[model samples]
Structure formats: structure tokens, C-alpha cells
Target: MKRFINKWWRGRIAKLDLCPLPKALAPLENGRVLIFAPHQDDETIGCGGTLALLRKNGCEVKAVFVTDGGGAGGLPEGTVAIRKKEAAAALAVLGVDDLVFLDEPDGSFRNTLGFEQKIMAILDQFQPDWLFMPSVLDYHRDHVAIGQALYACWRRWQGTARAFFYEIWSPLPATWVVDISSVAELKRSALSRYELPLAHCDYLSASMGLAAYRGLYLSCNGQSGLAEAFVEAENNGIWSGISERMLALRIYFEKLLKR
Candidate 1:
């Protein structure tokens, strides 16, 4: 069985493009990390492996679910409660208990001044060394809006958190990748708690596939492991990064308007 699994993984690895290896994240000794998820399951989907590693290395980690997730899965009346419960269970499995559910409405996340203030408040309170958020290029409107709002808040507050963007509905051009091979099963266990999402889309398989692809990249770089990928940037570069993205968006929309 083990040999068969190895053969299959190697076969998958063989087809992947071997890009320059992503920088490996050093384990935190006593650091603080924060994650902003547009919805409940994104935190687990995008960075569960890193979260597990952080906990294992004694890093303080907290997650903020920006939306109540009530607008998804066609069960509005009970969706929020169900998803939140699931998220709590999932995070608990990762040894993460400090969760903050912002309870904002899903699908209509705003990038307003008030929203920025709310995000800034959390930044003020946590002041994490590392902050992770959904990538701005994510196809989901809520994900994109939350990412923009968080970046705006960081600009205002000039918070000290080093920014990293995680992928979900879109893949980031990752500058760093953390080998989560050791904690692969832990990530699976955490994600399995999202019963509703898993029922709709086999997120477990999709997410694992991405991780496996990243692992192949790592292997090509001489590391035999699975990985979670991210676009890492220092605080100084965040505003510029946001500006570049906004400019491109504006150009695209302007062209659409001309049409």
C-alpha cells in the first residue's frame, strides 16, 4: 500500500512545472500569527498546515472569520451556526482556540471606512508578527473585498504584522512555501470538520491536490515534502502591492466601460 501511494504521488509530481523553489518559512519559537478568512473554512483550506506547525512550535496563533458565512450553501437560517461550529471544531483539532468570528455578512463584504476601522481594531488588539489573508486576486467577491479592506487597514494603522497572502479561489504567485508534509494528516482532519462545504465541493481533495503540487515543487528543489504556498511581503511593500493591483483593476474596468 505504501509503495503504491509513493508511486502515485511521484507520478503526479512528475507532471508539475518545477519553478524556483519557494522560500521555506522558519518555525516560530514564541511568535504570534494572525489569519483573516473571508469565511469559516478558508482559514483551514488555505493555511491549516501552517497553523498546525505554528501551534506545534509554540507560536501564538489567532484566526478571524470576517463573515458569518450565512449567505452560502442555500441554508441561510442555520448556515452561520453550523459553519461556525464546524470551524471551531476544526481549529480545535489544530490546537487553535483563539478564534474571532466577525459575523459580517457573507458575499457582500464592504471595503468601507467603517470596515477598515473594524479590521484595524483587530490589528491593534493582536499585533501579530505574521498576518495572513486571502489573496486579493481570489475570484470570490467577499474574499477580494476583505483582502482589500485588510490591506487598507494595515496602511492606516501601519501595524507591524508581516503580510502573507494565502490562496483559495485563486492561486497566488507564492514567494514562500511551508512544508507541511509532517502535518498533512492534521490539515486533513481540520478540514474534514467543514462537513457542509465538503459535501458541496470535494474541497479536501482539491486543497490536497494543490498542496501536493506544491510538495512536488519542493521536491524538485531537493526537499521531499508537501507544502502550503503564499506570497510574502514586508509591511513597506504592501501598499505598493495594493496600488499595483488597483491600477490594473482600474485599467481593466476602464476598458470595459469604453466597450
Candidate 2:
């Protein structure tokens, strides 16, 4: 039954018209991009292809790890150290050398003013031309917190950078897509570096599946390869719904039910 549903879902997605996504997000010469991940793997799982492409185009990319992934259960001791090493290796694959670790408590990201200020400080310091983060609707509590925190800062930061939201635990209603076919293999290889997490879950396959699902939204070559999806900050209503505080309350309860 599950297999049938999966196939049906794929077919239904494939038959839909191309989603209204812009062209691939390539970085300008010497451009800068900053990405925030609730955990180490989310960055690679979400936009590894885009990062690789940006680096190849002489873009300076920095990834900020919001948590150490130590909060996840069923993991061996020293998992945090292991994941950091894995992340470094993976980023190295894309020629990315700038990495930041916030060391925030995993599964406990509160959308507080202090937290927002910390993130805002980073944004003001980096002033990256492109900012990427987990989607607020992401099922993971940390993902939602970081997304909402960044969203809050974005409301005040006058920087010219464009913000985008990515997905991992849950698929987002994407308003933009990046053709990742060329870097698909690289993205897969990068994801495979996480031996610790891969031992627990086949994240490589899952990442590929999501990327392929996004590919189905493309018209070129009739979905030949992987693509990454994102929702532009201006277009996404993760905060501007009914009321920000009310929406937050609704999402909090919805998250509880989903759990």
C-alpha cells in the first residue's frame, strides 16, 4: 500500500505544470552567501548542489551550524564531534572553508528576542548577498525556530541580500527552484560523508528523493535530474499569516499534533 501511494504521489507530481520557480540561483562574481542549518546535515541535504555551483562561480559561501545534532536520540557518544568532522569534510568537497558553529541547544530553539539578536548580529556582520535557512514549516522544532528567528531579523535588516528557505524533514511549498542536475552527483557524494547519521537513517537516499521530487516540477527534459526547491522570503507567509503571534500559536499546536 505504501509503495502504491509513493508511486501515485510521484506520478501526480510529475503531471503538474512546472512550478513557478525562477532560474538557478547562481552567485555573482565574488558574491557571498550565508546558509543556516538547524543541524550539520540539513545544509547538505537542502542545498548542497547550489552551494557547489556557487563556489565554482567564485562565490564565497559560509554555513552556520545552529546545533550540534547531539539532541537527536539513538546516537552514540561523541556524535557531535563526529558530525562536525563529517560536515567539515562535506563542505571541503564544495571548496567551502568558512564554517560557523553556534552550538545552540538542539530541539530547544525558542523564538525569543535574545535569540533573534544573536542571529541578527551575524547577519549584520556577514551581510551576505544570499541567505539560506530551513523552512519555518519544517517539522523539526529547531528548524522552525531558526527559520522564524531569521525571519524576524529579516524584517529589520536592510541588507540587499535575498533570503531563501530550504527543506529537510518536511517539504516546503516552494516558490523557487534551482536546476541541480549538473551537481546532483556531487551533492550525493557530499551527503554520503555523514557515516554517523547514515548509519541511523539513509539520509543520502532521502535527500536524493527530495531533490528528484523537486526536479519533477521542472519542464526541461521532463524531470531528468535533481533540483532544489525554496520559498523566497518576500513570497513566503510563514509569519505574515492571519497574525504573526496567532500563526505561531497555531503552528506550535500543529507541531504538537504531528509529533
Candidate 3:
């Protein structure tokens, strides 16, 4: 891994067109990291490996699930409770002890009526050094809603955490990536804890596959890596830009779905 990464120091860039090679993450010695997951399994699907890596590097990782996860049709009774339990077990695999559930209506979650307040409250309380959120471009309404509400909450946010938007229902045009080759299997195990999502969709395999592919940007001639992609929104201006793009995406998806 060091050999391949050293290529960056030797003026090596761009593995190929459309694959603007992402770099590895610098280890965090100590800091508080918070993640806002739109659903129970999304946290594992999107950044479980990164979370594991962060823990290994001594970062305190916390998670927040914004939905009850009852929107997916055909789920068994008590889906909300079942999924929450699953999330608890999963995050434990990644060494995260703190978890918060917002219990918003899954499919109908919007950016108003206390959504922003909830986010602001968490932001105020956590005072994280790093924060993770769903991509603004995600097709899931709940995922987009979180981004929208966070943008609104940013107006009063006093925390100086750098934001990273992770991929779930959408693939991010990532600005950075964290190599998680060592913790990939841990992530798989974490994701596998979601029995409900696993029964309906092969999210475990899909998420691992995406991580492996993202690692290619960091891969040289060897296959010793997996990675999580993210769009870094480091400030209020960047958050505003994300909001504008999210609005455009909402319109585009609305029309596309109608068609």
C-alpha cells in the first residue's frame, strides 16, 4: 500500500479518465466523529469500514439514524425495532457506542417541522471534529431530506467539523476517499447484521463491491484495498452549494420518476 501511495509523491496522477484516483485518509489520532444515517443499514452500507478504521485510529465515532426504516414495503412486523437492534449490533462491530434515532417517517421525511431543529440539536450536543452525512444527490427522499435539513441547520451550527457526504442510494462524485482494506471484512460483517435489508437486497455484497471498486483509485498493481468515497463539504458555502444541487436533483428525479 505504501509503495502504491508513494506514486503520488512521484507526480503520478489520474489512473484513467473518469477515475480521478482518490487518495488515502490521514489517520486521526483523537477526535469526535458523528454520522447522520438516513436509515438503519445505510451507516453500514456507506461507511462502516471507514468507521472501523477511524476507531482503530482512536477517533470516537457516533451514529444517528434519521428514520424508523418502516417505509420499505413488505418488511415484517416490528421492523422499526428489529432494524434498530440490528444497527446497534452492526455499529458495535465498528466500535461505535453512541447511536441516536430520530424516528422520522421513512419515506415521507421532509426538511421541515423539527427536522432542522433535530439536526441542530445533535450538532450542538456532539460538537464533533468530523461529521458524516448522506450524499445530496442520493435518490432516496430521506437521504436528500437529511442533507436539506443539515443545510438549514448550518446557519446556526457552531461546530467546526469538516463534513463528508457518503454514498448510499447515490454514487458520490467523490472528492476524497479513505482506504479501508484492513477493515473491509469488518464492514461486511457489520452490514450483514442487517437481516431485514439483507433478506430483501444483497446490500452486503453490493456495498463491498462499491468499496472495492472505489479502492481501485488507490490501488496500484495489487488488490490490497477497499475504500469509501465522499464529497467533502467543509463550510457553510459548500453546504449551500450542495443544497442548490440537491434541489436540481430533486426536480430531475421527480421528472424521471414520473416518466
Provide the lDDT at 258 for model 3.
Answer: 92
Residue range 1-259, candidate 3, lDDT tens digits: 9987788756544554554455566646689999989899898888898899889989988898988989756667898999899999999999998999889888888777577777887888888888888877888877887876765565568768878888997687787888888888899889888987788789788898998888876764344577888877756676677668767977798899898
Distance from true position, residue 150, model 1, in Å? 0.7
TM-score of each: 0.84, 0.82, 0.86
Q: How close is candidate 1 to the true structure, as a TM-score?
A: 0.84
| Order of quality (TM-score) | 3, 1, 2
Candidate 3 error regions (>4 Å): 1-20, 72-74, 220-224, 236-239
Question: Candidate 2 residues 164-256, lDDT tens each?
Answer: 888888887677778788888889888988887788799799889888888876764344567898877763475466226533764887868
- Candidate 2 steric clashes: 0
RMSD of 2: 7.4
Per-residue error (Å), model 1, residue 5:
50
Kindly list the per-residue Cα lDDT of model 1 for residues 1-259, writing each as its tens digit: 9999999999999999875667777656678999999999999889999999999989999999989988744675788899899999999999899999888888877777677777888888888888898887677778877876776676667667788889997677788888999999999999999998888899899999899988876765568778999887555676577646753674575578679
Evaluated with TM-score, which candidate comes out highest? 3
Pairs that clash in candidate 2: none
Better of 2 and 3 by lDDT: 3
Worst 10 residues of 2 by lDDT: 19-28
